[model samples]
Target: MSKVRKVTDKILEAVSIFILGIMTVLVVYQVVTRYVFNSPSSWSEAVVTYGFIWLAMFCGAYVFGKRDHMAMTFILDKFKGKAKVAVEMINEFLILLFAVGVLLVGGYFGALKQMTQADSILPISMGVIYIAIPAAGICMLIYFICNEWDLVQRLKGMKEKEKEEE
Candidate 1:
């Protein structure tokens, strides 16, 4: 599982970096063409917009996998021992439900609905941009499962330790 996570992390990181790099270059090109050549490239602007969307989705998933997403942890901090682990498990379960129901299922269908709509400047369907939603949802699901497994293991260990102390 760790090996798989490591590979996923690396892939997401690389892809995010690549997208950012391309977006940066495209933005610069757009500015140069507008100011220097006196003609703005509509295609570059469209590409940059789509690239930003993809970059944001991928980066969000990467943050989820790293457990780095912002949260109000004050309530969570009040929990202790196995109770905390249980609460954490419940939290992860809720996240799993959201990822599956909202992101995976809903996003997939949404993308399908957009398949017939084409972008004004780009020579591609809007579905291509919507795909990032489901893709990131899949990544989130995987990370949620991994987190739940770890929480369960921690709960079991805590129980064993309590028995030993008694």
Candidate 2:
């Protein structure tokens, strides 16, 4: 399971890096065309905008997998032992629910609705752009499941250590 997670993690990391690289190149190209060439490329601007959307969505998912998300853990910090594990599990479940309900379902509909529409500057269907939402949701769901599994294992290990000590 962890090996699968590691492989997915590496893939996501590579994708994140690739997206950032594309964004950087596009912005640079836009800057060069606008200033140096004295002709702004509208297509480049649109592509950059869309690229940023993809980058943000993908990176958001990638970071979630990396467990680099922000949290207000003040109350959670107070819990210890089984209570801590329970609180963490609940937190993960809530996140999983949000990922499914909001990102997966809502995003799928949102993207489908945009299928007929095209961006002003770009010729591609807007649905292609909006698809990132659900993709990110799927990524998040995978991470949450893995996290829950890890937490359960930790709880088991803690219980085993407790038994050993006694």
Candidate 3:
């Protein structure tokens, strides 16, 4: 599991870096064209905007994968043993629910609804851009599942130790 996660993390990191690099280049080009040449590229701005949107979505998923998202840990810090594990499990479950319900389902429908709508500047359908939502949702869901699996394994180990002690 850890091996798979490591590989997945590396892949996501590379993709995130690639997207950021591209976005930077595109923005620079847009600026040079608009200010220096005095002939703004319409497609550049649209592409940058869409790229940013996708990058943001992927970054969010990456953050979740790293388990580095903001959290109010003061109260949680006081917990120990099973209590701490329980709290963490609950937190993971809530995140799972959100990713599956809000992100996956909602994002899919949102993109589907936009399938017929075309971007004003770009030739692609709006759905193309909106697809990022569900893709990120899947990424988040996968990370959450991995976390849950780890927690479950810990719980089983604890149970086994308890039985041995008894």
RMSD of each: 1.1, 1.0, 1.8
lDDT of 1 by residue, 1-166 (tens): 7776788899999999999999999999999999999999999999999999999988988998888999788988999998888888888888888888998999899999999999988889999899999999998888887787778888889889999999
Candidate 2 TM-score to native: 0.96
Instruction: Assess every candidate by TM-score.
Output: 0.95, 0.96, 0.91
Clashes of each: 0, 0, 0
Query: Between 1 and 2, whose lDDT is larger?
Result: 1
After superposition, candidate 3 runs with Cα above 4 Å error:
157-166
lDDT of 1: 0.90
RMSD of 2: 1.0
Pick the TM-score winner. 2
How far is 111's C-alpha from truth in model 2 (Å)? 0.6
Ranking by TM-score: 2, 1, 3
Worst 10 residues of 1 by lDDT: 144-153
Per-residue alpha-carbon lDDT of candidate 2 for residues 10-37, written as tens digits (9 for 90 to 100): 8788987887888789899999999999
Error of 3 at 14 (Å): 2.0
Poorest 10 consecutive residues by lDDT, candidate 2: 1-10
TM-score, predicted candidate 3 vs. hidden true structure: 0.91
Model 2 lDDT vs. the true structure? 0.89
Task: Give the C-alpha miss distance for residue 24 in model 2, angstroms.
Answer: 1.0
Give per-residue lDDT, candidate 3, residue 43: 94
